[model samples]
Target chain A: MLARLRWTEFGRDPGAAIARARLISTLGPLIALLLASIFFSIRTDRFLTTENLSLITQQVAVVGVLAIGQTLIILTAGVDLSCGAVMAFGTIVMTKLAVTHGVNPFLAIALGIGVCLGFGVLNGLLVTVLRLPPFIVTLGTLNIAFALTHITSNEETIANLPDPVVFFGNTFRFAGTTITYGSVLAVALTLITWFVLTKTVGGRHVYATGNNPDAARLAGVRTRRVLLAVYATAGLLYGIAALVLVGRTGVGDPQAGQSANLDSITAVVVGGTSLFGGRGSVLGTLVGTLIVGIFRNGLQLLGVAAIYQFLITGVLVILAVAVDQLSRRRQA
Target chain B: MSAVAARVPVLEARGLVKHYGVVTALDGADFDLYPGEILALIGDNGAGKSTLIKALSGAIVPDRGEIFLNGTPVHFRNPLEARRNGIETVYQDLALAPALDIAENLFLGRELRRRDIIGIVLRVTDRPRMLREARAHIADLKINVGSMKQSVETLSGGQRQGVAVARAAAFASRVVIMDEPTAALGVRESGMVLDLIREVRARGTPVVLISHNMPQVFEIADRLHVMRLGRRVATITPASHSMTEAVALMTGAASSQGPTKG
Candidate 1:
């Protein structure tokens, strides 16, 4: 029945060849991004400025790193809802140790990251070993991590961190624009993600596991291990995002990461990565993050209201998913 | 049995038994496949044909039974172990990852890494070599795929089946087992698969075909093993028994001809 359906769909022509069909499905968001950029530039003189572009990069750095982790998990047909909560928790650990306890800055950062890694491992164990649904596992962890953040810090923000905690916030001028090391770190991390997912056998296995896990097992992939490792690494990325958060704000704020989880997902979806998994790229996720960043920066420059900004972002996400679904249906 | 039936069997299973809760999927089933011949395993619903093949393919473990390859006793804990032992199965679903390229699927689990330092340090796949070798293999199989770079999901049914069989034929040093290879295909695509099975035999490896299509089975299989009620009730030659007689034997109408223990 599946073969017959496919055959009839081909006979119908549908006005698109296979190669064009593939290209259009994958590149539709990219073209939209270009059009959005053009429209924004026409409306505002500052939109295409080097300073504004670097500012957009700086604003998106934390989400960019978090989205990399999200992309990996999504590639394996999983999601990480606890990333924002986990990041907030990691920041508390780092700030409390570095300021409240007067611990070494590096050691404090390590402890902060350790807590995030623990959450990641717990998510992985629950999903892979216990065979729990990923959605439920991560949902439960998100709340647990959030509650832990408040209990650990007693709902207090740690301020006045040392210089080392703010190292990533260090800036250098290039081509008449100030660029933070954090943005560079985000780019470097995205490149690493692209290489790992594209070049290595493990990366291919991730795609395979997402595409058809039983087939992957038949082909001898350790799918459980792959999923577990992806979760653990995502936790590590959350930890990194925490430090970037500290660099940007210069204070350990527990209330800060509430929007991060939603934002990172928005970026991932906007970049063309599918929630269905197995057919997206990390670089596309980077583009997604930029799209989110550009839209926010553009809307703010145009003096749009906060409620309208939120509504627009929500609509964009839904539209992107609808486009993806329609394209896939057309292929079928 | 062929003229050289006395020679060592490539793969043999003895008294394989499996129980799924209260259901007995296989009961004291036995099978043997000699080299360079196609053995068709046919049965009605729930007659343990799949169970027996699962034991051989390492998809299922029998409660009691032993398997031997080339007269050496072997125990396969999973499908990977079975693959390493030179046993590959093309399941009824044609277990191929739809999003991956043909070259990637052809070497899915056993990708060839670069020989230089990058392979050791970074572990990059040697794409150039695998693509070239995969193209040659596909051409050798006479599979009319558009490109090795195309994902398997885009190929037609006959082409995809050909790829699956060719994958097994390329890797199976001892035997290839296909479970319902033609069940989902139309008549033309089924013909393509039948030809591929013949090509596999011609390439010097034996095939164990588990299919329900009687005409397709009779056309390719050199021998037939029939099962009923989770047991092997008959092993007959299609040349000797008519299709109706085979169906009657499987449906419990005709008297069981071969050894019950076999």
Candidate 2:
């Protein structure tokens, strides 16, 4: 529908050329994902099976949710290095309250999300009020969240979570293949976020703020408020990611998600969202997350070493960013 | 033109005093903008012309001053407040989000929301309505940017200026203050902006234009407000003063003939 609208409006509008270019850019990640899947399928019959495909979706659930939040932050030309640690802290809070502190399961979940929201607000206040660089502020909060997670959980893993906490982790059969509710939630959240970003006033402000903050401010956008809302909203998404994490692992492990910060960022960049901000889409991010999942699954199926996967992922990230820079230069 | 002076000023400022910690940017500046006239504010680089304009447009709060809109004292806490009172300013930088389309830029801060449940619940903007209105606004100003959907960055320097001016003209019911609207444009583009200013005045909105381009100022402005040493030194009409005399008054080389009045 969007493409049709663009094409219909293309008459007598020279801007259609640029709009076409953007459409191609958005499709870039999906193309890469399809090609990668084809290569893996050709290499190993196991790669094409429903079992392995469902496994990939299950594996991507947590990181997929994390990437949603990451996409929002990166859209504002900001990065949240604390997202992974914040999710870990939230998971611990939820599990500890329910299992150890005997808090109501629903209240425990809300409190966990609230704690994550608080951190987001704190990050926002420091960035807007003190006017600190986002990199430095998030870096500080990253360490703070990491420390708090360990302190609260006592460097231990909490298992046997209540039913409500583990609800999303449970599997349901769909078309003869098992699917986790967490995966559905991740995809749902992505669509909701995409709607909010594309169809609302707040979404436009996010793009405007990222594109040129001074201009946005002069145009009557309360840019500081926009930034604050973005950080706070991203933080809330991270807390939801924590729930997905607990569901998948069935344990609140303090040591989990140590590499998640970089992983989620990798997904966003690979999905074709610009790290410079204001130009990418969450739908692209969905493709990006799958791309990462496919590569890891494909490599493992092909008997590549676990360590080799890290090397390949690193190379992919740099390549994606290089493509972004080249395209930006061309636009300039 | 003489009858305009007898009417109450649409926008007026008295003794606007602003200091920046050991440096006074605006020292007791007084300004008056009458209805349906182009008042060009001209001053040298450090003569505090921008500072005085900022105070009136709500970009900065003056330490000591009173501003009146339609004879009613008004204090603007920010640019949005000024805008709510029917005053708009086009900053020197143009303040345009380059990645956003011209229609989006026109409705950047003050987007129109849909009136239905979709808008009420989801807060979805009335994008189609905004696009229609934006096209009308741009067309009314006779700007030929081709498409309202094109991002501002894709437009040429002159086209961007047209977008900025058109925005001010569309929303400003009482006054439009433009700070060097043509400083970055080519000669042809500058002339187009001067025409835009004239078109704005034709619609009965008074304009407060800040320009260093003396010829353009004299060509379009009805009255010239010359600032020197952080205050209005003289208010002269093009009929009464030459370009050389305006420059001299702006640089403190020539003294006013008498106490300055609007």
Report DockQ per prediction, comma-separated.
Answer: 0.45, 0.42
Inter-residue clash pairs, candidate 1:
none
Q: How well is each residue in A224-301 modelled by candidate 2, as lDDT tens digits? A: 999999999988998999999999999999998888889999999999988888889898889999999999999999
Model 2 error, position B62 (Å)? 1.4
Q: What is the lDDT of residue A24 in candidate 1?
A: 60
For candidate 1 chain A, the 10 contiguous residues with the lowest summed lDDT are A7-16
Give model 2's share of reference contacts: 0.57
Model 2's TM-score against the true structure: 0.94
Candidate 1 residues A132-232, lDDT tens each?
98889999999999999999889999999988887888889988899899999999999998998999888888999888898888989999999998999
Give interface RMSD (Å), model 2.
6.9
In candidate 1 chain B, what residue range of length 10 has the lowest lDDT sum? B1-10
Candidate 2: which docking quality band?
acceptable
Alpha-carbon runs more than 4 Å astray in model 2:
A1-21, B1-3, B258-262
Q: What residue pairs clash in candidate 2, if any at all?
A: none
